[model samples]
Target: MTDIVVSTDWLADHLDEVRVVDVRDGWEFDGIGHIPGAVNVPFDTIRAAEHAVERGADPAEGMLPGVETWEEVLGGAGIEPDDTLVAYDDTHGVFAARFLVTALAYGHADVHLLNGDFSAWSRDHEVERGTPEVEPTEYVARESETSPFVDFETVEAALTADDVAVIDTREPDEWAAGHLPGAIQLDWRELVDDDSRGLKPDAELESILADHGVTPGARVLLYCNTARRISHTYVALRHLGYEDLMFYEGSLAEWEARGAPLESA
Candidate 1:
């Protein structure tokens, strides 16, 4: 298992050692059973309305909450700064990856995504129907030494830089509507396994990325409609050893709101 991804089998063995976070909605957490002892950190908990307001972007755009918000949400969920976290969701790990990215951005050193979805886990393993009691911890969120997040201006500047490759990780319909100029469209779904709902093998992932000229040596910038879907691709690239990575936080939402140039293919 890679540092960012942990298989079901590995998770089964290490369940006691790590905190399992279910990023699915609250209804799913109660109606659809979840991994035993996992805490349901609903998908919306990590987002804040103020992010858009603070950035002067569209209020409709989803954005990561501030560090204090993250600290409250994570600490209230009983997750400590040093705790190893394993996040999972039913949306082919997209939601889970978002939580992982949020944690990493807040300076959490140890975080991982469950290789498969909650359904996969319930198929062969035991699940619990109710919420588990959690002892809240005092989680201190440190300033990120090197954040993966990037602003709209930084991405705009990179549009003309030869050394950087901008990638749009949205769906075909979204891409068809509009996208950043010079941005390559590689739907985030392409990196996922159809059968397992997990990431594709590293070899296959590398080949697909290589075909798009997104090599390890190039500084890669990833963005989606609101920075949610691209989180999956971000984790995939990290697993493949793409060290120089940047995420456009506001994404196309900010771009369009700011009247930035866009091209349709």
Candidate 2:
């Protein structure tokens, strides 16, 4: 498919032809088995620099890093812009989607996500229990118009847009704590299959979005604590044919840090 998600059988056949990225931490990679010939690229490696700062994230989570940063990390990991990539994570697709979003923001258009995540893959196929040798490359990422990677200012400005739906993809508790005014709380986990973390049946998802006042054709906006969980929601919405999809890169982490007003239930 031209879109980002891929099936297990499809991935199995293309392991050699495409670059398979295991977007899990080193410990997880060593403990849980991974796909053969896959390279381990941790999620945090490509995260925006502000996440590293202990204080108010100077920027915010999910903010796309600079060209030099992507060049170094992705290049050092042997990820070339030309290589067709399928990224996956055992953590229910959070890290995988994040990496895909980052890669796309930096103009790598060939990246896709494993349909059901690595956990689903492990259940159905044999997985190698060790890391594979990575042949690093000098892959330079050119900037593309990152349409969906919105910033705090853009999100704040779009809050009142007649055609926009600002969705908070956090848990109910988090939503109850405090959320952006008028932001609908639709937990990202609700949109996926329980085990595989793949997008749920299209009809079911369409109904869910409709129930929340998010029309299928609306310009959709998503955000969460750090923008990680929201990526799952973004992928699900995209699969459901929501064309005008965007993510608040500097999500609630940046919003609350800025002393922005929140509506506590």
Candidate 3:
């Protein structure tokens, strides 16, 4: 399955075929208008926990809600099991990528992240401004227990094992301050270079990994400040045909709270 990026023009052309999911929080969309026909899927709704990750915490936290909750949410959106899901958010696609990853984990065949997120779309003037009013639909409860995620315990165990490669997908500064023990640093920006947002290209991500001795079939456990940005790397790795890849959904905050062994490089 391919994760395709649709331009504003492209989205305009195939509005019916594609489902544009606006992942902005309530305040953002309510204050500012959103793309016409885009359904609001508030970022807060997909919480890792009742409370979220704290700033500057370790990178191994987040949780997937029960399948019943997901089914209600997806079904309420009128999402057909087979429709193409396109998710976007204002930031560097952290929210969008997480949602896309979540949906794909739920067995939705066609889920994509809007490149550069809503900010890029707005910069291109590719977005339509409107207060979308979607009628609440009757959601049928469909139970399925297949949420793709990794908890702090699993990450802690992997850190002690030589077989699993623990990757820190946070920035260089974050990596230097503190990171899980035995984890290798590979910034998420290495995968998606967003210079406009103070992100410089580590143009040779795969090469850098190769230098770090990350092999083709290495079992990777990817984590970041939050699971959001790292999910993009998770998707990209899978896209690159890596078979044994997994993302730590809770990320750094949770890991630090549990007092897991960490190293400052």
Candidate 4:
């Protein structure tokens, strides 16, 4: 697996070589300065609104959009399937990781997340005030043959499967309120280093996961309130060389909305 995290210094050296994507809100991209030559692809644009309703889930739940939508949104942002993408956001890589995960799911092979937050970049490097010039491309996205995202049925089955480990990447309060039965709590924040605001060392991360019974050997299924928080943990696990990993896209929102049984702390 390719190294999914790139340092700001590495990004600075190769800014022109890669497609720099600022995954912040539109207002933030324009109002706050951004890395020069970077294109703004707001996090919300990549996620589907009212997607849960289609899955018999809450109407407010956000899920990954369809292939056509991804093709349009990414292509409009001047991103081709073969583009070397580096996505960053103010939220310590979570929003950026979400974009990377979505791109990977759509078979974009050379995607990466910028290590640390955008604030650190803006503070140290020169930034542009407005949108950069972009010429849109006709991008075609193909769904990956082996996708990391798993549906509700797969998650439901995993609950009873001894080999599968269902991990809840939510806060203590959220897990306390309710979570899927047999789901182990591993808050996504633990995967990130507080000082650097990037992922912890690989061994440390692996140790943390192992402590929670989330070993790489086991088939890991991760989820949060939505798919957002878990995206960070997903990237972290991938970075640590975990192969048999899956994400519950609908997550707790879908689980609860569908009247599935839940176990509270």
> What TM-score, to 2 decimals, does candidate 3 have?
0.72
Which of the predicted structures, 1 or 4, would earn the higher TM-score when compared with the native?
Answer: 1
> Considering summed lDDT, which 10 consecutive residues are worst modelled in model 3?
195-204
- Model 4 RMSD in angstroms: 2.8
TM-score of 1: 0.90
The TM-scores of all predictions, comma-separated, are 0.90, 0.87, 0.72, 0.88
Residue range 171-228, candidate 3, lDDT tens digits: 7789898887877887666666474321223345567667766767789888776567
Q: Which parts of model 2 have CA positions greater than 4 angstroms off?
A: 49-65, 251-261
Ranking by TM-score: 1, 4, 2, 3
Error of 1 at 162 (Å): 1.7
lDDT of each: 0.83, 0.78, 0.66, 0.81
Range of the 10 consecutive residues with the lowest summed lDDT in candidate 1:
53-62
Order of quality (lDDT): 1, 4, 2, 3
Candidate number with the higher TM-score (1 or 3): 1
TM-score of 2: 0.87
Residue-wise lDDT of candidate 4 within 1-265, one digit each (tens)? Answer: 1688888888999988899999899889988878888899998889876545456643222377767888988888988777899999988899999898888778887888888878868767888887777889999987586468777777788888889888888888888899889888888888888777788878898899889988777888887765678888888877777788877766555567778899998
| Clash numbers, per candidate | 0, 0, 9, 0
